[model samples]
Target: MAASAPTLLSTTSRLRVSSAAAFRAATAPLLRGEASEWVVRGEATVQVLGRSVRVRLRKRLRMPATRMEEMRATDVSIERGDNATGVLTVASRVSFFSRSSLELVQMGALRVHAYYDAGANDPAVPAAERRARAGRLSSSSVRVGTVLLPNYELRAGYNELEEQIHFDQSLGV
Candidate 1:
């Protein structure tokens, strides 16, 4: 019998911290290239391949309370130890009332194992093997982002011919 083809998979991860300061502290080492492994939890970790940060905007907002709307963005490439590299565009907003938030604008490509059901019920395959092969799929074929915010605020163009995924969301804070 011919060998089965290798599978490819993709995934997204969300992380929330108590405060933006904490988030910065956690990512400081990685950003400085001091570390490569980011321990998301006890056993779950991701390898930081590279990262770059830029100040998108910095201004003073004189509403609700006098606060600085300093928006900084970072482009990061990470590996889940699965040989898949996930590139992400993340923005961090630090404002008053502790009403801070992180925005993830996902683009680029990642890869993983692809799962097929051609021989799903084969008893020869172990349960763990079957489970891994059940839902493993590549992450390169997905696009998740905000539209209205990027369109009206940033005036970002979305050309289907370019396979562009442009989006944004603002609470007008």
Candidate 2:
């Protein structure tokens, strides 16, 4: 009976240690948060010189950190245009509450230009003008709307240049 008691005690302690390690492993991801990568590619129709032109839009977004009710995407690039490409890099912060889970509020500002290859061949445009053209382009936007997780998102954004609203809803299985 005495030997059996010591063996039972050792087994119980081993089980406790294993359970604690399992608990830590299960909660680590939730506490530390996981980063997600998102890529969006689309085309936008723009009217140029009374003619419609299809411009390719590609955005690579990274959500590096997420908390209980907020998420931050520090690395975001939005590229627009087919000929004279303009790249806009932005950092966005989004917040939401439980009562208004449908309404996700987002604020974003242009961080820098990854590339703006416009008027590079024009000798009439000074070197300084070419470099400053991208610097002069600045925009900040605020958006609000419903964003269903992992599936659909709808939002209206008001920026320095324009107010645009878009929706993305997935259908079928």
Candidate 3:
């Protein structure tokens, strides 16, 4: 009997933090190539496993910065750590506001894993992945920058040609 092909599954989740001031403070030093330790306090909305939950969270981060990069187009910069890790705790009310509460569940802990590489933009990236991302742009629309204007017309033409190439390849033409 022949073996069946393995199935690939993908799942996505979203998390939003309402008050990020503390989070920003914690991450600021890490972005500056320094060893830093700080705490973050905020309200978070997390959607996972088809369930939405709102809770208050406190996160402690301690990591050393590892990589930094500056973009030439807009003078924007970013930094990250090498295999950064942290921990966080969350608390949420199990029942609606009432005097008679049966139980209080607190101190739900979670582990954080983070990794960054400065060479992401290098040529080692697969061409197919690059093409897939560029294929999302529609050839019909053109938007100009409000500041330090760029050549939108030329960019549109290039994108149209790229889309045509990908379309032709799909049809085996």
TM-score of each: 0.18, 0.22, 0.22
- TM-score top scorer: 2
Can you write out model 2's per-residue Cα lDDT over 21-118, one digit (the tens) per residue?
A: 55434433432445444343566799989999998745453423322332222233333223232212232333322221121223222111122234
lDDT of 2: 0.32
Q: What are the lDDT figures for the candidates, one per model?
A: 0.29, 0.32, 0.30
| lDDT computed for candidate 1 | 0.29
Q: Best to worst by lDDT, what's the order? A: 2, 3, 1
Which model scores highest in lDDT?
A: 2
Say which prediction, candidate 2 or candidate 3, comes out ahead on TM-score: 2
Residue 127, model 1, lDDT:
76
Off by over 4 Å in 2: 1-32, 69-173
48-152 per-residue lDDT for model 1 (tens digits): 456444423222211111111222222322222222332222332211111212222331221112123544446786877655554333332223323211211
lDDT of 3 by residue, 54-159 (tens): 9775555344452222211222222222223311111211111112111111212211112222233336757665444331223332332111111111110111
Clashing pairs in 2: none
| Model 1 deviation from native, Cα RMSD in Å | 23.7
Between the candidate structures 1 and 2, which one is better when assessed by lDDT? 2
